[model samples]
Target: MSEKVRLVILITAQPGRGEEQVAAFERLAPVVRGEEGCLQYDMHQVSGDPDRFVLIEEWGSKAALAAHDVTAHMVAADAASPGFRAGPATVLEISAESVA
Candidate 1:
């Protein structure tokens, strides 16, 4: 079995489009959370920064994460991003590690 996958995505919306982006994510959240491997899928707006947002996600495994990337809703979000986003999202993969 593969390890779980975690990702943090930073998204910046085009000027004056922050609310629209938030609404878009609100619409998308339920669908994504219902996916087979979805564990955590949450979005948070940056404090005092209306144009910035952060998305945190966790998947059952790498394979599950890969499957998510190709979902119809995800594909549509990618296509619509250019209109609302300032640029491509910054995604950071994460994991818990011990140094001790």
Candidate 2:
């Protein structure tokens, strides 16, 4: 078996457009969480900073994550809100070691 893939994304809404981003994500959550290889898909807002958002995704593997990116829901999410003004686009992607 291969290592799992986890993704963290930090994004900021456009000026005065935080609500738009939030609304879009609300629509996105269910669809993202419904993907076959998705172990988890969570959305959050930064404390005291409504415009700052976070996307946490866990996948069965890198291939699964890649496939999720091309799914219709993801496509709509990107088209609706590009996400983040500036930051590490992908916070991290760790490969868990296999049990020997």
**After superposition, candidate 1 runs with Cα above 4 Å error:** 97-100
Candidate 2 overall lDDT versus native: 0.74
lDDT of 2 by residue, 1-100 (tens): 5657877777777666668767877888888788878898887888888778888878887788889889877776666566534333456655455446
Residue 9, candidate 1: alpha-carbon lDDT: 98
Which candidate's lDDT is highest?
A: 1
Provide the clash count, candidate 1: 0
lDDT of each: 0.92, 0.74
Tell me, what's the RMSD of every candidate? 1.9, 3.6
User: Global lDDT for candidate 1?
Assistant: 0.92
Task: Please give the distance, in angstroms, between residue 54's alpha carbon in candidate 2 and its true position after superposition.
Answer: 1.4
